[model samples]
Target: MGNNEYMQNAVTGWMVPHGEHSDIVMSTRIRLARNLRGFRFPIAFSDEQAEEIGKLVSDALLNGGKTGYAYTRMSDLKALGRQTLVEKHLISPQLADAVHYGAVLLSEDETVSIMVNEEDHLRIQCIYPGLQLENAYRKADETDNLLESRLPYAFDEEFGYLTSCPSNTGTGMRASVMVHLPALTMTKQINRIIPAVSRLGMVVRGSYGEGSEAPGNVYQVSNQLTLGKSEKEILAELANIVSRIIVHERKSRELLLGRSRLSLENRVFRALGTLSYARLLPSAEAARCLSDVRLGIDLGLIEDVDMNILNELMVFMQSGFLQNFEGGELTAEELDSSRAKLIRERLRQRAADGEPHPDEP
Candidate 1:
């Protein structure tokens, strides 16, 4: 790409924002989704002829892209008569109610986009507020938005903020694609092509990115270091990556389709809730869960739970219970100091039932 691309990306700072948070919060948010683009092959196959498109996407993502999610068209548990190929571990009990939104089974030549929510993300909205705020806000998303206001950088001592230069602050752009590049990473031709590839605006990192390592042997080329690059520069990089990704995607379209790609959307949330309540978890536990949360999103298994915020929030919410960490809460350990005693009380009759459950402490 040329400097014109970078120059075009340079724009004035005039973003209108939503939900007010300190700069620390604005800068600590993680990029949750990919700005998707797709390619269509010359030929299409009938639904009945498809056996493995979903697996194809899954393998490709697991091998090449940072994020991997699939759509399953297999029979549904509640359908008139069908059975899906997804494992029970891939399904979450909490989101069992929202399962419909969790998975999709697309036909041949179909495309899907991924989205994750940043709880209090601000978008520069135009034409909606008073003239002062009009057109000042960035678009609803990063690809089309502006970084109107940047907050100061801060860290969470308890949960530990994600540390890396050019951090993916507010509305960080998370671009993941389905690439069929098992050999591309090792090929000599590709080695020569990388410099040209990256100059267009991408970083060749592992599946997870800088914060975490790739789960398996997969390689990911995401865009995380663009603080100084202009919008056009970033877009050019994204477009270039999209172009290369299309080639790989097409190669795998035949072997992988009509299958599911995510594994832990609900479980991740449940884990979050569990971690939040399990005050016993130390800093390492919190850090591990943070990566787990990231895995859930990258694999298309989970939805919008900000790990950094969730981890810190867990400590804040449970600070009151740390005193009980010594042994037990006054309500239980103080009264009986024995598991048998607690269980026995729970099963006792009203007459034998004893002290109030709420005030036993």
Candidate 2:
């Protein structure tokens, strides 16, 4: 499918709920940063040099018997297009800002994407639905091997892989899982949990990763250091930590259901009612409501609505995706209205198709 066509589609493999803990865990991602030998890092590279590196990396991956990969230059995409990609997590905010010679090579299913001329010469990434870190790592490692076979990498006898950032030097691998922790957040346990996790070489950031706010009670938990650990060790450590966090979240959820069942159910149904019938919905408010509704589904407070729709709405409600659906730039006010319309239409359709309304007995 073409880039525009792919962007418009609601379903991607990673967005679907599957694997272990799909209820709370959104997805797992593995990213490997590698720089080409004898080339300057992206920070100091000229436009010509960036172009050269982009071509070299793209050629190696697309021509090295790897089928189903599409190459798109960052400069060729409009702001909306790039923002759409960022919202979908197919590319990073940094890559979206790369309006020069930067490019991305995306697999057909979008499970794998290689960003060329980002912070490094290549940022190889693979993502999977719901707590599948091992699967993501395996795919990323396979792509790394495919590229390393065809392109020379900057490596060191001591550091393993050379990257622009010192923190990413050794394994050059960042393993992360996106999780919904509404129960913990509501119970005020997230504050304690984040610091405790950080003490264990893990960092928790908002859904879109670093430097972003966590809307919808969604957060990305990732390793903080890659300098001294092997890739296996890093992945194992992160998996263990995330599993524990999941257990904590589940416990908090049970506590909430036990002690404050009426209050929790009231909050969830109110959020669902707002989403189902509101005439105007801001992006942030929409995200918050969606989180509550998702919590309701997981706790069995509500049934019939598919979790996949909530996942899709999380991306679709973003400003860029909403504007893309409308085919124009929108003022903040317009976006709010459009977002509400989209939500109401979607939820109303589900209701029309035999799903009971939130207000129904």
Candidate 3:
């Protein structure tokens, strides 16, 4: 798809947007990794073979399915554009660097995306806005089934599906939820729980997924093993764990309000104050401040600020997005200044409309 379409469509179609329990449950996602029957794994392929594989999947997606997906050649996108896609969670970091041989197929609404020739020959994923595990899984499964019918997928009667990673050999399904655990973080609970969750075969990774660090108290929790587990079992187990975490987060919020209401208010308002007046804010700092502000809004400590502003900030505040918004490349210093200006303007606009003022802090 064109950059215009990607820029417009991705933001609107983000899964698990801000909503009920969304303060804790940011989004739910299910990813299925599959390989074509005869193609060598991407690493094993010659450049010629990779090109052929790309065309093969691209053709199948564009012509074989009823789904109206827009296809974008990875080679056509600039590095910043590709990074923006990663920030949107519509593509993986590996896929961003796929360079000449990779491509992505995204549904018009951006709910479903298939990464061609990533870690696996194809990574088909579906996303839901909130804590909808079953819904995300169902959509992902449906998309996978349709693709399997149209293309030959490598399978083993003994192992299930083959993938580049041995751990993904069986169901090749990874179901995960992106949650905002600021309360858990603030209460010093997440540090204690992370290792415990790891022992349960659950993995907690940063917001950008595996190998990334959790920023702004946002965490992505998912099952660690896809092998030997049925899709239903996997989804069920993940849902149970996520639901419990949701409870813990909610309780943490309650505890904060009951025991440290003044402290909480000070922290949140300070964050808003920085965002309102800072002339230059780093992306990491912006993320931290935004998290506090978003938490304040969700907890009703601050009202009249729309959730959409926070959600949109998560995207446009990123470095690549800042450059995209300004329609050119930006030096690091310029990006910091621009990010601060954007946040200041948005918050001020809301305040001018008679919303809660951060000035009190």
Candidate 4:
């Protein structure tokens, strides 16, 4: 599998949920930066060693690392670990070479998360489908074996690591879905939205929304009540918001989708549809094929086109009969012919229908 294709699958297949899990995700995660904390061990582990990695991490928590999660604060390591391993120059500052590359203090669970944080500390996030599925499977596994383990252990495995406040039970897991509502939500409305979301037992923050912010537009909302609320209630709320958000988003797109929008929308839908069938080939190769088509048009050698349509086209072309093309290399004649034909067809065929448009022509 190629990188781009893998990236695509990792996003669509693993990150975005399907069927019943749809509302569980806010959106694909966008990480803008990383906060790295290095650590060194005076001694390296042997080949035969089990590498008390988990224990060392647990014991090393005293160096002022806050809970790797937002909800899990420095004062609270109960959900993740007893402590986090983010001590910089905390030990033996005088011992110069006793350690290896300091271990990067990743998040509480050590799972990479992709969210942008403005703070000095770095954060990571995983896309919704990817992480949610993982947690779901773990929860199902733990529940399946409920008779064998202790209640606390089992619950923590399913929720956000057992919390003192029972509301955060069963893996302490809460998922939020987000929407970028700049058009629907004015700056004044944003202030109101926060308390509104919080009031619904949903949490909201800046774009990128849940964990951090990125340059891209996104807003996340996750469930707040873990124990009291049944999974059904949380999921229902997520679904409702997602539905409403989709309506708002569609309206926004309608307002913004321009002359070629209909064609572009069709093109994008085609690409997204094609993506699901790409498993027959290596994913990266598929992505590259799609990327080439996109980049070709983007470079202006292929033709004048909407980049968004191009992106969507990438997904469609991946699994189609002809899935590969670079956007570079459009000759003047080719451009003129395609453009003229496109324009003429639109004027003759569907422009007068008073329908939204058949812009692709």
Candidate 5:
């Protein structure tokens, strides 16, 4: 599909529900930072150097026996298109903001993407639905190997992979998982979970990763130290920690259900009611309501509405996606109205399909 068509579609392969703990764990991602042996990092590189690096990486991936890979230059894309990519987690904001030399090589399913000249020479990334760190890492490793054979990566014998930042100098791997923790957040236990994870050499960032807000109760949990650790160690440690957090979140959900079923149900259905009928809904408010509705679905409080719809809504309600859908930049008020209309039509259509509600026999 072309870029426009790709953006218009609501679901990417990574957003589909699959793998372990799909309900709570949204996705697993593995990213490796590597720079070319003969080139400066992106920050210090001249425009000509940046262009050459982008070409080298793009050519390697496109011709590296990857049948479905397509390359696109960042400068060629409109602002809306670039922001839509950021919203979908397909590309980083840094790459999207590149003036002349940033580009991307993305597979057809979007499971694999390479960011050329962003924070490093290449940020090779692989993402999959739910908790599948090993699987994601395997794919990323394969891609890294493919490119390493064709390009000279900057490396030191004692330091492992050389990167722009000292923190990423060793293994140059960052493994992360995006998780839905509405129960923990609702119970006010997230404050405690963050510091605990930090103590274990992990971090809990917002959904978009570093310096982003966690709308819809979605958070990205990733390893902090890539130096002095092997890829296996980092992946295993992160997986174990995330598993523990999942247990805590599930228990918190049970606590909420046991202590205040009526109240929880009221909050969920009320959110759903507003989404189904509201004439205007701000983006942030839509996210909060959707989180409640998704929590309800996971807890068996709501059944007719599928989890996939909620996942799509999470992206569709974003400002960039809404504007792209409307075919123009929108005022805040216009965005709110369009977002509400989109949500209403989607939720109401699901309900109108004659699916049995939870109360039905």
Candidate 6:
């Protein structure tokens, strides 16, 4: 398929909300980093070798899959398109900006993506809506197995998977979940809970994973240690921790409603007021505002809004996605104005549908 078509097609069915805890648990992701037996890491590869590596992984991914599987050469896409993929979490920023050859194999559902020639020969990842760790891991393991049958991965007698990063040396697996913790943030409990989670061999990363800020009260919790543990053990441990966090978040929400209903509603309504009336909204402000509205929906204070729309806005309202959606570059002021306009339109449409808004009662 063509580039624009590929980008649009990749988003199909992928961003829709799913799972029982989907209101709070945004998504689950499992990634396995792997390199081929003889090929050098992406950084060490020459021009021709990088091309060969990309071809090898791309071809193998397409070998037995249906049309849902797509291969896109990173170099072929425009810079904006690559950034859009990054916003969608389908590819990494490093892979998007790779100098040498790089490509990605994406599932039609947009849940599975393999970054070829990214730090490793392959960075295979599976994403599922809501708190579905086991489901995400199942798909990731299947894809890894299928690829392994066609290509021999670099492995050591002592380590399971030989990766460029020492931390990913064994198992080479990273399991994470994106969650909304507005209650914790609103109650100032996140500060205390974060260090405790760190002690449990877990990390609370920003919304888009490492090195990003927790915009919209969204955080990604993932395993820190990958060495020495079996893949099954790692998944089990991460799942247990995530479940506990989910419980905590739910309880916190209940507490807020029980003891501080008026205050919570006031904050949610004030956010809605700014979002619907603002003429210019910065990316960060929009994220934080949308986060409150999303929490309102989760708590049944807002009936017109849906989690699916909130999830889509989480990505589409980003600066890169906004520029790409408009099909051209925008000045900083223009982007802010456009983001506000978009938010107003979305919230207005939902309001016009006759559902109860947070400000109504």
For this target, which candidate reaches the highest lDDT against the unseen true structure?
2
TM-score against truth, every candidate: 0.25, 0.96, 0.93, 0.37, 0.95, 0.93
Candidate 1, residues 1-361, lDDT tens digits: the string is 4422321222111111122221101111113221111211102322321223333333333344323334433234342111111111112122223223223322121112211111111111121111111122232333122122122213233422222223543233444321223223323344654476577556655432344433222334556653455434554555466556545533432222223222234545655444434424443344345444434443444444333332122222222222222233444333223322222222221112243333232
Give the whole-model CA lDDT for all candidates, comma-separated: 0.30, 0.90, 0.84, 0.34, 0.89, 0.84
Tens digits of per-residue lDDT, candidate 4, 1-361, equal 6534533432233222233323223233222122222311223333222123322332333232435532222322221121111111111111112122222333433233312111212222333332243444343333223311321122332443333335554433455444434333422444565676677677765432335541113356666666656545666675565565555544544453444445544553453333323223343433433333332332233333333332222223222112112223334444333333322332223222334433342
Model 5 CA deviation exceeding 4 Å by range = 1-8, 351-361
Give the per-residue Cα lDDT of candidate 6 at 209: 77
Candidate 5 lDDT, tens digit per residue, 68-131?
9889999889999899889889999999998488998988889999998889989999999999
Clashing residue pairs, backbone N/CA/C < 3 A, model 2 = none
lDDT value, residue 144 of candidate 2: 94
Ordering by TM-score:
2, 5, 3, 6, 4, 1
Q: How many residue pairs clash per model? A: 23, 0, 4, 32, 0, 0
Worst 10 residues of 3 by lDDT: 352-361
lDDT by residue (130-205, candidate 3, tens digit) is 7888888888988887778878899999999999999999999999999888999998999988998888889899
After the best TM-score superposition of candidate 1, give how far the Cα of residue 116 lies from its true spot, in angstroms: 14
Please estimate how well model 1 matches the true structure, expressed as its whole-model Cα lDDT: 0.30
- Candidate 6, residues 1-361, lDDT tens digits: the string is 6534533453534467787588888888999999999878877878888888887787777765636888898888888889888988899988998844888998877889999888888999998888888888998999999889888889888877999888889999999999999999988999988898999999999977779899999999999988999888988888888889888899999999999999999988888888878889999898898899889988988766555667777787887877876779999999998898777766655563565434411
lDDT value, candidate 3, whole model: 0.84
RMSD of 6: 3.5
Error of 4 at 256 (Å): 5.7
List, residue by residue over 1-361, the lDDT tens digit for candidate 2: 6533543474678888898999999999999999999889999988888988888888898789999999999889999989989999999999998888779999999999999988898999999999998889999999999899999899999888999999999999999999999999998999999999999999999999899999999999999999989999999999999999999999999999999999999999999989988878988899999999999999999886767778888998999988878889999899999899888766755552476555522
